[model samples]
Target chain A: MERLWNTHIIEVGFDKIVEFFYRMSEVADKLRQEGLYFRYGPERLPEIIRIPERGTLRVKYGFPIFQKYGVCMDVTNVEQALIAEEAGATSVMVLDKLPYDVRSSGGIARMASINRIREVMDNVTIPVMAKVRIGHYMEARILEALGIDMIDESEVLTPADEERHINKWLFKVPFVNGARNLGEALRRIYEGASMIRTKGEAGTGNVAEAVKHMRTLMNEVMVLTFMSPEDRMKKAREYGVPYELVDLVSHLRRLPVVNFAAGGIATPADAALMMWLGADGVFVGSGIFKSQDPHIRAEAIVLATSMWWSPDIVLEAQSMIDEAKSMMGIDIRKLKPEELLQVRGV
Target chain B: MKVGILAYQGGVDEHRYMVVEACKELSISCEVVNVVEKHSASNIDALIIPGGESTTILKLMKRFGVDEVIRKSIENGLPVMGTCAGAILLAKRVKDLKTGRVLQGTLETLDMLVIRNFYGRQRESFEIDLDIQVLGEKPFRGIFIRSPAIVEVGQGVEVMARYGESYVLVRQGKVFASTFHPELSGDTRLHKYFIEFVKR
Candidate 1:
């Protein structure tokens, strides 16, 4: 062991160690020039931030969705983002239009303006997520350059590509996409999505589709969990995702990524019910703003989400919202097949 | 045993998940307290300050009066465990690594002095297996994210663990602070250890 150690030390050589220090000193000198001071021994060594040179992204840079009952609110502007922060939202999804506005505006809903996203980023302390068109790589690039926390390749934002989704593996930050079933969820995971949300009917202010999607996804996962390896492989092939992802879902019996319920959550009870149905969290947009009191309703939704297991707390949360004042919720049955956002992405 | 997590800011979900998991393993009851206001801090056996951006957390804590409430609660025997940014807030003094300026809004609950971003910037953030003797022979995986380093400690402070030559975890009475995030480490030992500490 001692001989091997000496041989290892000799092979390492003093010159390489000196060269390492030389490069380190160069970096330190640059940092010194930058006016940043160091606290420990020697001079303040300016650190060279390690940038990944190659390989598949580790899904490290996205907003953390492992939060217990995280509340993700959809905000169109800075004021709403601030209100979300005040209301205990774990993160805010910045978009140009909520589903309500999208349904009513009847125009091509694209990514929110860069200036608007910037204003929200500057004013907020919590993680800020923005949406890009389903296949608009440039919009995702712009959001990435702006140092946005997460990007949603959303169908609600009008599909930028008809046949393909953004290659999420190409980006440094994480992408979240909506999935209507286990296959869609797994496909998105194979595409490098770090988080998944149910592609429920947006702006509808109803929770049926969200519930349906979550149920369908979970039930499918259970079936996959019980399948044989060959069967799972066949299912993976059928779903157009890798077998490894399918294997992971089989073992975990759930989506490998954080699964959240989004699109039509309108009340605190609606949020809690989604949580009880195995959703990691819920995302609300028109629900809070379209209510009698956004401040109270927002806080109530956040409360119900966090205390989902407790019926009494959920009841308390329910009492805070005025049911009559909620947004005019559109039933999923009324929506024509062409208007279904869930059917947009793969 | 009932434990509370300060959920108004920073890794609220991550910490709550880990702590709740810890409580489940330990077979104890736990509650996540969203410390958006002073009253929110009441009625918990212990409190956990999760990792996140320290300045923003401090600013929010002060704005919502959670800082004072936490101070009083800790004074009144509420055992607290602060990780990463939480450690910075608990320190008596926080120094900026860039300018060596004393940053404001610290709760001064812990006796140590900390230097922010001592582990470097976000890009330099990393994870490593640490030898914390208290956690037995197994190396504790410490996740350091824009983490600070505890450079100095008062006479009352006890060094719980270290990485290299710097102190990473320290305790002063019921107050425990760690410069690394245990919640993100996927290890339950630290949470279990903290829960045991809280139980005592």
Candidate 2:
């Protein structure tokens, strides 16, 4: 009797399934007439299949939704974090050692101490971010447990796993990853990175790599926008990212998430240049703490980033800083390929 | 109609897109401007303060000498909507959620007391469907990112919506403020309501 009832239900459900598909196609046609089909295209149906709960989706997208633009200062200690916050920095990246120090002391670099990060969080009202080694899922877990605002699966620190990065989708707190070009950026996004930053050479105080990465990413995005659907799919395959993400980028003409310039940005002019080149914001690693006067320099960088469109305000910001006090920059050409930080994480 | 968004930092582009889209839906011809300076602030029909770090926006506004101009403009009956950090800026008093200390240098345009980061940190940020009656029967999704909470409202202020115990949306005369980001939700009802408010 139970078997007969189950078979009867299946037979009846089959026609309902067919009817459902028929109605869905009809709805799709109407949406196409309204020019909204591409936004909810069939190719994006897989994303719907993998959708998390509504609450989780909200937390996942909230990082970029409320991301504070302008200057994101990298600070090594509690005092530096406090100063950065007071100087109007949108956020501060907590580090166990400044990039320059990490370069000077050659050893295995790991996440910052929990106590120090806690102290910084206690001292400042602004958002606090911390870094974890590339592919270091354990460190990411630890940071998430500590209730850090954001995590950077950073290449500046040593890579914990050379083959794979931490699956960002598993974590609730948003993760930011570094990318040198559009392909790398889309790949990181596919891995659930909520934000992307240029993988410029860190601890060098040189903006050339930062400029090159930004230009390369922007130019690739522009090229993608002009590509045919078939070519975009081919590009997506080449990028090893989802086709829908590539298609979305082609339509939107920009990264799906906020893209900030990071690594070796120093001085007010450099920050402004990155902004002019289309960075959503900037991250100054060793620039502030290594400068002659960190407090004034931090404020100046914030000013330049906020008012990059106005040359007079940028000039005033530049005048506030003494050029002689700037960090001694390293020539990128002098560094061996093995010593370069940007080449670490895929 | 011309609308200006405080464009120094944060989600300026998001707000601009929402306003433009709302205007198009309403069939209202609109000019959207970035209110970066005094001249831009004073010439706009309505002003929007986009969500960011309130301290950062306040500091830059004061630095560029536009803070006072914006305050006076709103005082003179300029319809304004403040979201998230923008809402914090319009409060009469702002207190740190953790320290319970008062934050100084806000615009003090609205008669309310707000607690900054009242919902906790970014990890605590959320999105939920809210029943905003002023927006009609359809529920509006509220995206609260490190959002503040209105702890107290003055006699003149009307509470329009709430999340649990605290008020999330409030309006007094021509000034409207919401502790959550309506721009990020991809909904234009609140923007349409603001446009109508400006029209009136």
Could you list the chain B TM-scores for each candidate?
0.95, 0.98
Candidate 2: which stretches are off by over 4 Å? A1-55
The best candidate in terms of TM-score? 2
lDDT of 1: 0.73
Docking class of 1: incorrect
**lDDT by residue (tens digit), candidate 2, A9-111:** 1111111222332343456567777987632211111212112122244454555545545788999888898799889999999998889889889898999
- lDDT of prediction 2: 0.82
Clash totals for all candidate models: 1, 0
Of candidate 1 chain B, the 10-residue stretch with the lowest lDDT total is B119-128
Question: B1-32 in candidate 2: lDDT tens per residue?
Answer: 99999988888877887888889899999999
For candidate 2, the per-residue lDDT at A272 reads: 85
lDDT of 1 at A148: 78
TM-score of 2: 0.90
User: Mind giving the per-residue lDDT tens digits that candidate 1 earns over B105-164?
Assistant: 688989888997675533345556677889998777666655689989999899988877
